[model samples]
Every structure is written in structure tokens, then in C-alpha cells.
Target: MPTQPKVIFFDVNETLLDLQPVKESVANALNGRKELVPLWFTTLLQYSLVATVGDRYADFGDIGAATLRMVAEKNHITLSQEAAEAALKPIRSLPPHPEVPAALRRLQRAGFRLFTLTNGGSAALQDQIGHAGLEPYFENLLSVESIGKFKPHRDVYNWAADEVGASPKDCLLVAAHGWDVAGAAWAGMQTAFIARPGQALYPLAGPTTYTCEDLSSLADRLVD
Candidate 1:
């Protein structure tokens, strides 16, 4: 039988919370130009990685606002810092995906130490979990900002293990993103890839310990 992890570290955005609200907010912010929503999000993720790769640290919210403004400029739109911040303000209150709450409860009941290790900033992460009513579901909410790097960086993964007081092998990272799964596995932790729609494992990485269509599917295996 495959060994189960004592600690299960989750990626917050997209993995746990539904980002459709952010899309809706951005649509309204752009005067119904929903087309810019995806572009703005992509730019946000891109710049986050850029900062990480450059060995610099910036809060997730700050990077998000900067990218929103950058994307707006690229498209010749006038997006002020206030407007960008307003658009992203919805992130802190995003609702959990339908399957997430139940699945998380199942994992906790099954005796797993559930924790959140997000690339999001400390204040934003606290607001997200509290607003979603998910604060009690996790033992601890961790952020990579403490380490000055982002996901896919080895430091974040190893640091999470240290915080949890577990060896990397004793923890499993659950995430919807390929890079996060790949990073955890490479960082000496086991991984479970939630194969969310339009997401696929990276071609360069080896297989993970588990791959499921959603949180419920993963819970079905992890929880009796």
C-alpha cells in the first residue's frame, strides 16, 4: 500500500477557492470588457514568477496590482492603482468550490493534519480563509512570503515541511497547478495533483502519488 502523508498541504487559489468571482469583478472593473480578465490574470501569474526567478520578494497583492496596471497599459486602458486594487479586492472573499468544504472535512476526519500553504500574502490569506468560513478547517495557514519566494521554488516546499515539523516525505502537497505539484515532488515531498479542467501535469515532471479530477475524488481515496 502507498504510504499516506501525515500532513497535507494545500494550495489556496484555484485549488480551494473558486476564482470566477474575481473574473466577474474584473469584468465589471473593465466596463464589461471581460476579455481582459484572462489577460490580466495571466500577467499577474507571469510577473509573480518573474519576481521569484529574479530572487526578489513582493507580496502577492502587490504583484497582482502591478500586473493589472501593466496589462491595462499594454491594452491602452487607463487602470489606476485604486481600480486595480478594487478589482482584486474580491479575492479575499472568494467562495470555496462546492466540493472543497466537504472534501476538506473528510480529510480532517480521517486524521490527516490539513494545512494551507499558499503563495498569497499573510493578510490576504487570513481574509480569504476567514471569509470563506474555512479558518477552522486548517491547522495552520502558511504563506511563502516568509521565505521571499513563490511556488515551484524549493524553498517554499522545504520551509512548509519545517513549519509543519515533518520530513518532506511525510507530507503531500495537493494542488491544481502543475508547477506546484512538480515543485513539491522535486522538493522531496509526495504530491497529489487535482486535475482541474484545463489543467494537466507538466510533461517534464514525473508522476505524482495521486491525480484526481477534483477534491472530492481525492478525498474518496484519502478518506475512508
Candidate 2:
């Protein structure tokens, strides 16, 4: 029999929340060049990793703005401060995936403690949760700010497990990113990979103990 988790820590972007609209917004802002969105996102992740390795940190919004400007410049596009700001405007208003609310509600009702661990800063995360009507579902919001690191950094996962007062073995890390799962698994937590479309698992060793197509399916597994 599978052991039930004492706490479940979720990844925000791409897991519970859909980032497609934000990508589209950035693409539109970049004058129909959709490729810029991925470029910016990759840069954002790269900088976050650099911060983690260098023992430095910047808020997600700042990183997003900086990366957008860099990407714009690289593409020979003139990016004003206003335009960079506009590119990130959709971050706060991203809609939750259709299955998120129901899955969260079901998990809450089933007596599982829920928390969020995201790369997003406190303000951005708060705005997103409020906008998505998901604030009521999570017991706590754990940001990378607290750990001065990003996902795939073992310390962040350790911090989350510690904050919830659960041993890593008793908690589950749920995310759409295989790197995140790999990190959490290495940190001793069980992992659930949400096979969200457009994301792929890394061909690496990790504790990807379970897989689900959506939050609802994951919730069903947990409750069962």
C-alpha cells in the first residue's frame, strides 16, 4: 500500500497555474515574436540557478524584468521600462488550470495539509493566488526567497519540509518540472510528476513515484 503524505508541497507555475497566457502576452508585446517568451523564461531560470550557486538572490519580478530586457535587446527590439513591465503584467493574473481548484478543494477536504513552494516572490505569488481564488486552499505559501535558492536546489526543498515540520520522507513534492522532482527526490521527499503538456521529464534517476495528467488525477490518487 502507498503511504499517505503528511504534507504536499506544490509547484506554482505550470503545475497549478497555466503560464500560456503570460507567454502569449509577452509574445504579443514582442510584436508577434513568440520565441522571445521561451528565451526570456530560459534566461530567468538561468539567472535563478546562478543566484543559487553564488549564494545570492533576486526577487522573481526583478529577474523577469531583467531577462525580458536582455532578450528584447538580443532580438534587436527596443524594450522600454514600460514595455518590460507590461510584458510581466500577466504574471499576477494567470488563471489556474481548469482542474486546479477542484483538486485543491478535494485534497483539503481529505485532510491533507497543502502548501506552495514556488520560484515566484511573495508579492507575485500572493497576487496570483488571490487572482485565481486559490488563496483559501493553501495553508501556507513558501517562496524561494526564504531559502535564497531556486528549485532543483536541495536546500529549498529541505527548507520547505522543515517549515512544515515534516520529514522529507513524509512529504510529497508535486511539480510539472522533472528537475524539480529530481531535486525533491534527492532531498528525500516522495515525488509526483504532473505530465503537463509541453513539459517533459528528464532522462535521469529520480524518485518520480507517481504520475498524473492533471491535478484532479493527482488528487484522486492521494485520496484513494
Model 2 gets an lDDT of 0.89
Q: Give the per-residue lDDT of model 1 (tens digit) for 53-99.
A: 98888999999889888877777788899998999899999999889
Off by over 4 Å in 2: none
lDDT top scorer: 1
Clash number for model 2?
Answer: 0
Which segments of model 1 are wrong by more than 4 Å? Answer: none
- Candidate 1: C-alpha RMSD to true structure equals 1.4
lDDT of 2 by residue, 54-73 (tens): 88888888888888888888
Clashes of each: 0, 0
* Residue 135 in candidate 1, Cα distance off native in Å: 1.3
lDDT of 2 at 37: 80
